[model samples]
Target: MLHKFQQFYPDLERLINFIAISDEYVAKAPSQERFLEVIIRLEREVFGTAKMRGPRVASLRVGEPKNLRDCYDTYKAQKRETVEQVTLELETTVRTLVTDVS
Candidate 1:
């Protein structure tokens, strides 16, 4: 469990980027749905279960170029306001599609 937890954030981020890009390119909704289905299945294998929220993508530069871990640590160090805004935006978007049965 601990080992999986360590890798979860990056894995999660990848899933977010995949979903975000796929949606933005609506001309290929089939391609996006196909990829998302595959990723969802794979994630269940690796991490048991995940709940989709909004999508998040960032070009973050973590300190200590040699240390990828430092990059995530820097992500954690970012200001609270920036983080919350991004989170809320994603939630709103995701929820709209998720609840839109029309």
Candidate 2:
């Protein structure tokens, strides 16, 4: 998965690698809550308020596992949408440029 993303989305691949390595390190936390906290902090740093952190902050007052999962799902959905929108805009811009040149 990381390899496939490397060519077109190096930044995303790097973020995935960082998250995987971070999870491995945080896996040794003394408590599950501690592990979750560390994971959330790492995610917040990577994804920030524009993506995942906003929903996490608004909906995750309590650290329930279900809420965490929900927030993650929301983050994934929003990220996917944002990527698609950017790709579409880039394609449109390129097409317009090509048409103008022709």
Candidate 3:
């Protein structure tokens, strides 16, 4: 399963691109969540499955957007020129996520 990442894309390349090119507030993301997200993307796209590391590697394939590369590239481009807008958007997003909308 790990080999899938090797087949799909280079880790260094993806990390470099994600950190250098991503426009999202991914750097501000909670550490564990960020790690999970990165691992999930790498596993699903490259290995065709995702799983936790263990004595037995149980992986399952999940659907991924064909435009993943595009999405990633766009996300990288999402930087706000103004800090105020960036702060407000982050606050709003957090609020929405926390709000109960049943």
Candidate 4:
């Protein structure tokens, strides 16, 4: 459990950092899904869980760069939509909780 926790943040941080500077990576991808595949693989490697691949396509690979840009629209629209929906839900839940507390 401790090992899992320790690995989680760094890996997730790497994912965010990779996404931030991923223009070069995404540009090199043969397809958007292929790029996301790279991300999924990284997540598994860092987190040691196929579950991290989540609902995203399970096209894991090694030594490929990926990005969030075309992972939607040209890639997988549902992934973006899912993220947006989750963001909205979290925001709404937080707002409601704050309002009730006050």
TM-scores of the candidates are: 0.28, 0.26, 0.28, 0.26
Residue 23 lDDT, candidate 3, scale 0-100: 29
Q: Each prediction's Cα lDDT score? A: 0.58, 0.56, 0.56, 0.60
State the displacement of the C-alpha of residue 1, model 2, in Å, after optimal TM-score superposition: 34
Off by over 4 Å in 2: 1-77
Lowest lDDT sum, 10 consecutive residues, model 2, at 57-66
**Model 4, 1-102: lDDT tens per residue?**
888798798668667655654556667766867676666666565666535334654332232233546445633647767677656766776676666656
Residue 95, candidate 3: C-alpha displacement in angstroms: 41
Error of 3 at 49 (Å): 0.3
Tens-digit per-residue lDDT, 1-102, candidate 1: 999898898778767655654444545555655665655655665676655757734232322223335346555777575557556766776666556633
lDDT of 3 by residue, 46-89 (tens): 76567776444434433322443434544566644344555566
Q: Could you say which candidate leads in lDDT?
A: 4
Model 4 TM-score, all chains together: 0.26
| True-vs-predicted CA distance for residue 39, candidate 2, Å | 47
| Candidate 3 error regions (>4 Å) | 1-25, 54-102
- Clashes in model 1: which pairs? 62-71
Residue 74 displacement (Å), model 3: 28
Prediction 1 global C-alpha lDDT: 0.58
